[model samples]
Target: MKKIEIFSHNPVLLKECVEGLEIKPEGTYVDATVGGAGHSIEIARKLESGKLFAFDRDPDAVLVSKKRLSSYPAFVINSNFCEMKKRLESRGIREVDGILIDLGVSSYQLDNPKRGFSYRHDGALDMRMSKQGVTAAEIVNKFSEEELIEILKKYGQERFARSIAANIVKRRSQKLIQTTLDLANIIKFSIPAKFRRNKNPCKKSFQAIRIAVNGELESLEIGLEASFDLLKAGGRLLVITFHSLEDRLVKQKYKIWSRGCVCPPKSPICVCGNVPLAKLVNKKAIRPSDLEIATNPRSKSAKLRILEKL
Candidate 1:
């Protein structure tokens, strides 16, 4: 087996998340998506006797993070965040004091060509965040043009979804699209020559295919709900999302859970007896500072949203 040199990941909005968690010296914490132990290490440092349960679906990430955080005695689980509630229950951990979810592809994954996350890399078109899923190549080559267009429009927010889908189907007819460069080229030709000059013309299509292949957006919807339920009263959840689709889901879920009642105003009194689950700590998403953005261009699109359980 070949050895992979995995680099440490810089958690986006690191300070913001740690502060929002309001870490207590002896409070239990959970890092639902411990990509590279970035925030997990800090959470462990702040804890005197508190325990952190770190979860990640990627085996590569799990191995690296376990090694990086080995000294801290953190419980690292190889599982998706959507199953976090069940996993914690089995571990005899009832409620957590704080939960931090960094919901973006890690730098390590993007940088690794074998992972096929970056359009720059010339590798197999496999964009699975975990080893247990379909690949980007399958989605691009097998999906119907309409299905492809829907993914591009919804996940990527691409304006040329129709044209891109049409071109993909047209190209795949002659040859199988099996690599990052192959798909990138197809996306490039789909757009008119004038639009090709724009920054990252392939970005939208690649993002769309990646999201679909990994079921990322769907998992976010479920994971957000699970995270809210896992928190103990007064416990906080800090989620960092990278794109509009993710940010929108996080915002909408928080708004619903934060609502005081669901009954119509015409009702004389509250019927559902619903209480707010969490309160938004930041009504507006927190963003990276100019200095941070200058240092890490990837942080430019990050948005951090926090909620304290009521």
Candidate 2:
């Protein structure tokens, strides 16, 4: 078998995430999505007696991070961050000083054609981050038109979700959509010619399919709760989300956690007896600087948010 060469990953909002963590030299921390170990390396270097636990569902990422972080006091686990609480607890770690979760596809995943993450690449329609679940091709061919439309509208925010879903069903009836280019062509043709010239019409549909295949949004929801529950009082949880949907979820959750009461506006007394779980580090999401976006185009959509346990 050929060895997979691990490519260097440029971590988005690198300085901001580390600063938000406020790393204590002897404090234990978790790097929930140690893609390419870019952020993990930074977190590990700041440690003296502190330990870093890094998790990644992708086997390729596990191999890369394990080697990259081997020099430091870091332990790399091959698992999804959604199971972080259970995994950390199994290792006798019930609480942590900080947790950093960067929810963006690594540059390596997109740049590598075989990964089938990019529509620009004419590779197999296999967009599994772990390479162990339902593939994009399976979804495109097997899912009902309504199911496809729902994901396209909800996850990708695609305006022409119905049209695109119909086209996918129509095309797959003739033959299986087995490759990224095949699906891209169908989506491109589904949109109006004028709109196709403005941007890649396949972008939204591809994103929607990938998210559905990987259960990304669902995992994010579970992972956020697990991360928050595992943080000790005053410990921080930093997350970097790439799109509006993800940003909105984080924003809403933070709002709920920072609230001191849940009583109805009409009620005079605090009957709910709700207490704030955490306070937001920033009122708004922290976006990448102009230089960071210019240098790394992929960081353009990144929005960072932090909450400290109360």
Candidate 3:
């Protein structure tokens, strides 16, 4: 077993999440995606008597979070954030005052070559956030062209998804695509010259593959709803999303919940009488300042959105 290192992952929009949480000194809170316990530590510090439940799917993250938060009275659970309800129920805890989810791969995962998260590393094509899930290698070699295309198009937002899929199929037929370099090379060859030079061509494909491997986006959507339901009235929910897809999902979900009704514009009377569940605390997402971004480059793409239950 590889010994985990004590490297730091600067949590993006740290102050925003802590503030957005609207932490009550004696109110319980949950850090659903407590990677490295960056935000968890802050929450724990603010709590006088309230408890903190920190969840992480990755064993490595769980281990690291345990070490970081061990000093505080915290319960570190190795579970998917999507299973927030059952996990909390098992603990006999109900109605948390706040929840925070940082929905991005931790610096540890990306930095560790063995995890196979970064295309920069020549690691095995295993991008499972949890040890239990299917790997990127399985999806790349086993999934049909259509499946590959769908993943690339939907998750990656890659314009050349079809070509990438075609190339993957072609290459794997000759040899098993087992490593990061193998797939990265195939993606490089599949894309046009101009496209390859502008940005890391393999970036999107790797992201898509990772998402599929971990079911990350789906989990976020599910976890968001679950967290919403778990919050007590006046309780707050804070989400820090890295990319556009996540931001869009969070935005749409918040909009739906914040709206008074979902009936058509021309509907006679408000037929879908769904009262607003919560109000968007920040109509515009909060972003890290330039100084913070300079100090922690990983914070650059983070967008923080907050909602308070009515």
List, residue by residue over 1-310, the lDDT tens digit for candidate 2. Answer: 3367657679999999999999999999999999899999999999999999999998888888888898999999999899999999999999999999999688889878798988998899999999997888888999999999999999899999999999999999999999999998888888999888877888888888888888998999999999989999999999999888888888888888989988899998999999998999998889999999999988998999999999
Model 3 lDDT on a 0 to 1 scale: 0.90
The residue-by-residue lDDT of candidate 1 on 35-86, one tens digit each, is: 8899999999998888999999888888888888889858899998999989
The TM-scores, one per candidate, come to 0.95, 0.97, 0.95
Q: In terms of lDDT, which candidate is strongest? A: 2
Residue by residue across 169-260, what tens digits does model 3's lDDT show? 99999999998888989999999998887788998999999989999888999999999999999999998888899999999999988888
| Best of the two (2, 3) by lDDT | 2
Evaluated at residue 51, the lDDT of candidate 2 is: 97
Cα lDDT listed for each candidate: 0.88, 0.91, 0.90
Model 1 residue 140 distance off true place after TM-score fit, in angstroms: 1.2
TM-score of 1: 0.95
Candidate 3, TM-score vs. the true structure? 0.95
What is the descending lDDT order? 2, 3, 1
